[model samples]
Target chain A: MMKTKTKIPEYTSPLIEQIYEGISQNTFDFVANRMQLALRISEAIKAKNWSQKQFAEMMGKRPSEVSRWLSGTHNFTTDTLWHIEQVLDIRLLAETNQESTPIFEADRLRKFVLQEVNNALEKYLSSRKLVSA
Target chain B: MKFKIVKLSRFSGNKSSLYSVIIDGEQETLFDTFIRNNVSENLHEVEQIFATLNSIGKKVGANDIFFRKKKEGKAGDGVEAIYDYPSAKLRLYCIRYGSVTLVLGDGGEKKVRAWQDDEQLSKAANEMIKISQILTQAIRDGDLSWDGNDFVGQFEFNDNDEDED
Candidate 1:
């Protein structure tokens, strides 16, 4: 509890507030990715004019779960991120598909295989049309 | 508990005035309690929270994009919990008065799957809810109002009676 009916102190700068100077690169990256991702997701949700409840339904999650995601507390799994990407139509894991330094080998290969299959289908359809003509 | 709101210079800026709650009979504000409890145990998350606060205070002006709206849809301007998104074990709850004013409450580690399962977090969040109600009533009565940076008029409220009733 606080003091009884006392005047609140005038705003005073903290005396010698020690900042987190010399943050390690690893920690920086870790924190940055989490914060940025959370912000991006929240922003996207707001842009689409969906409340957490609506977004949660879209992701097939409980509203509480989506609240945690935006709270920056949810340690989003790759699967959850993928689900979010699908629902929001945003590339949260875009870095994973980078041409250089690909993060997820299996996922990148899956995309590559899908592209190849689509290209083959297109080629076959075009050749059939040419032969018929 | 009755409390007074005070502006914190460390987290304050031209764009926004960050505030903390100091409950009656207590020496520390909720923000102070938050730092005292977690500054040693979870320095990394503490730093991350500080960075977020810095961005909110200095850059973003406590926008909704920076806060997680308490999905409860309960009143108090929809109390929000402070988090850095990508990772956090700690959670600081707050009520954002638009973009320029943020009132911070105490926080602790989320030891369970949901914050409602965590006593400390629930208390902190509940406190914010109460504060939000008080603030909303105050604004409605014109007892308090935001003046860009700091609050003008009566910023203090006694809610012990209401709590008892």
Candidate 2:
């Protein structure tokens, strides 16, 4: 019997290029961290089969407020983070054993920076070539 | 669909990097124009969208921001070039048709409530629907022709055309 393969959705975005061009690594980490938290919360809510309304009720907040919170933009404060963890019974923040945050790891950040710089330089060279051509 | 990218610097005061679709020869660029205007809170979102499109034009043939499936009926079942930033609460809508033409529509911050609760977004959705219908019909009626990847021939839209009625 042959195994049927599930297709993995490609998450490429044109904005990634712009992000590389305009944003700093710290900014990237900040946005990515927030998105990660939002995803986790969203997944946990889905796993519990709860609607935003239900979750809002549990959190003693309005549905509209919860909707914004889960919209992947809400900057979670420490208190709110703790409160959510308490309510969801899930940890929203990672507690790494490393001395520094894993996101700021020297090697990984260096690789990402190099890749972005190379992409920009490559684009610049190509455009210059087109202009001269 | 497919399209020959038409650079829009000649017809506008905006950056040369911006692109729209040429159906036959008419520029179907309402979306690009809206981005040029860049109203209110969407200023940042529109700028980001513009840059994203320029980047996509250079590197990938089409990427997520260039072609995205939108909510059927809500967006008239058209493809959208989303400028989705949760922090900004913004989305810009677009529609591509006949493999060679794309038109843009206005979009703004998504209401926390729902789209139906907001009049502007609803209007934008209606605009997407209207453009989609017009472009598709034009292709079906042989008023527009595309060679899978590029547009060919000439097109003119008459205000009093029977299609409008």
Candidate 3:
């Protein structure tokens, strides 16, 4: 007898496609990128020999919620992302520096070196004066 | 603080390379480098690496040498290697100092290992702490949105409404 085929759940709807594409092209590639990342997280959890229930407890979320996140069907919010970062302890992005680069130009290097030398000389003189007194 | 790229290596059989960056005198961070030879590949591995590093309390920043290239949009100017996987691609930038090593990358699936002296391990650990702090802040701020992508909305069918009608 032939075995019947089980139907796979339709996880990718038109709306999901739109969202995936929109985020992939418009905002950040992280939308679809996150799906794979979530899978990796799941794998990492498994590697640690933790079950979904245990992971949920660790995350302070309901097991069902963890299941949803692992399922890759639920949409994620910024707050959720923040929570994930807090719980996972990872930096998902890089910080931008506000300072301009010209400030570190080699032309100013001499001034900084002279200032440091002067400060060191002042400290040494002060220490010597205190010792003598 | 001044930063340096120290080591670049391939993870598994992928094309992306894992990177380590050394900062100031004591801190080290890991990153997934995404651009190699001026090409962009799958960044999923980089993201995974970031997640893993973040989960462990590593901080990341653009100023970190691991993620910084000599020139942006230039092919092979400073990027050492590129790792490509089915899900994503990654570039690796390694910064080494004394006995410490730092790794950096774009979000991708690549992994990297760096060789450094035992004396540098302490500095590497300190670097990891600083990187972890940066990573934690980035994750908290949702600054990881790199591709400029987002979910627009969700629609659900209302069975109860249909039944009432």
Q: Please report the candidate that would top DockQ against the real structure.
A: 1
Error of 1 at A13 (Å): 7.3
Candidate with the larger DockQ of 1 and 2: 1
What TM-score fits each model?
Answer: 0.61, 0.44, 0.24
Tens-digit per-residue lDDT, B1-165, candidate 3: 233333332220121222344343633223321222112232234333333232212222111212323322234323322212223333333321111222343222233332122223333334444444443333344432122111111111122232332
Question: DockQ (Cα-based) per candidate?
Answer: 0.10, 0.04, 0.01
**Which of the numbered candidates is closest to the native, going by highest lDDT?**
1
Candidate 2 residue-wise lDDT, A1-133, digit = tens? 1111222111222332333344344444554455446657877888889886898899999986776676444767888888889988898766757587666687898997897787657545543443343
Tens digit of per-residue lDDT, candidate 2, span B28-69:
444543443443334335445544444333322232223445
Instruction: Name model 3 segments beyond 4 Å from true.
Output: A1-31, A93-133, B1-165
Return the TM-score for candidate 3, rounded to 2 decimals.
0.24
Model 1's lDDT to the true fold? 0.69
DockQ of 2: 0.04
Which pairs clash inside model 2? B1-B99, B2-B99, B2-B100, B31-B104
State the fraction of real interface contacts model 1 keeps: 0.22
* Tens digit of per-residue lDDT, candidate 1, span A1-133: 1113333455532311443332333344555466567778988998899987999888888986776676544578899899888888888885656466456887888886786576546535543443343
DockQ, candidate no. 1: 0.10
